[model samples]
Target: MKPIPLQRRPRGKKPLWREYAEALAVALVLALVIRTFVVQAFKIPSESMLETLLVGDHLLASKFAYGIKLPFTDTYLYKGDEPARGDIIIFRYPNDPSVDYIKRIIGVPGDVIEVRDKQLYRNGQPVRESYIRHTDPTGREPLRDNYAPVTVPPGKYFVMGDNRDNSLDSRFWGFVDKSAIKAKAWRIYWSWGGLDDIRWSRIGKKLL
Candidate 1:
């Protein structure tokens, strides 16, 4: 008599630990990419910008507004639109490459920017600033008239700290180039006046 064949046992599923590890690794890599090419977080380090942006104000930056950039190259794969005056911009300081400074674009390419007394004149016309707090105005930069007829060179930008008085800006150093810009600030996402304290009302504040 022939012996009956034995039934084969089924194989058990692989351990869940392997799957969890793989998922975690992928998540971390994705986060890094997003941080580099997409939105980035920035915190104001000084009060150079007062009412517009205060110290410790956290903000979101849109890198794609300009164009996409390679991970570690100075070359621009895609040339994007140029910046305009009155836009708040984030750019690498021309004199100091290691520093990233944020300021408003007061003058664009081929625009004449100058200040008389404590008032500002753009291209022979005055810029009406209603947001500034006139309490103890810092006054205009000294010898500002000497720098008049400043035609913004192509591919360059003029930046200024909102505080106006204490800021080291284009008036002091020089113009910021198109390549130096990192992103355009959009809004105040979160704020902390002190420890364990968060100001919720400041969230979603649109930047000018």
Candidate 2:
């Protein structure tokens, strides 16, 4: 009797489970890369930005706006353009690196920053800020309303919140180093005041 022909297994074909796992792994890697170097999302936990960005606002920040940083570290892999004044940035809190904060860049290196009676002055010139919100105009706080003029050091940036009356920013902590900046606020993807208050007007709004 002739022996049955030997069955030949398919060559270079992966098992279905393996294929799925490989796909999942690739997806995870891509997501990590994107989050680390491309863009990231953050929720507004406080009214630091006020009219510009409200609490409960979910926004996307461009991680590559300043440069590409090494994954899991503040070191830059390929240094690119630096952040400029008026750019809203998310950065590691200088006082506590474990915490992150968001604020607008008010003074670049060598810039003189001061606040007199709640009016911001850069380089001894009053800045025109149409986005700032002052809830208490008559209130007087030493660092909040009247700050001594100080020149920003090299590689350091002075940042502050639009809600000048209630924000704890560079004026309170210290200058945020360039390396601490992680991303630049790009656009608002979602916003809501509460369960019953979805801010439709704020959604998709671009941050200046």
After TM-score superposition, what is the CA distance of residue 16 in candidate 1 from its true location, in Å?
A: 4.5
lDDT of 2 at 131: 89
Best by TM-score: 2
**How many clashes (backbone N, Cα, C below 3 Å) per candidate?**
0, 0
Clashing pairs in 1: none
- Alpha-carbon local distance difference test for all models: 0.80, 0.92
Q: Which window of 10 residues has the lowest lDDT sum in candidate 2?
A: 69-78
Q: Can you write out model 1's per-residue Cα lDDT over 1-208, one digit (the tens) per residue?
A: 9999998898887689988998999999998887877888999888767778877789998887788778778766666656877788888889988998999998988888887765678899988876543333644446432355577889899887776666778888889998899998888998877787777877889898
Residue 184 C-alpha lDDT in model 2: 94
TM-score result, candidate 1: 0.84
Worst 10 residues of 1 by lDDT: 132-141
lDDT of 2 by residue, 58-149 (tens): 99999888888666676778776789999999999988889889999999999999999999999999999998999999999999999999
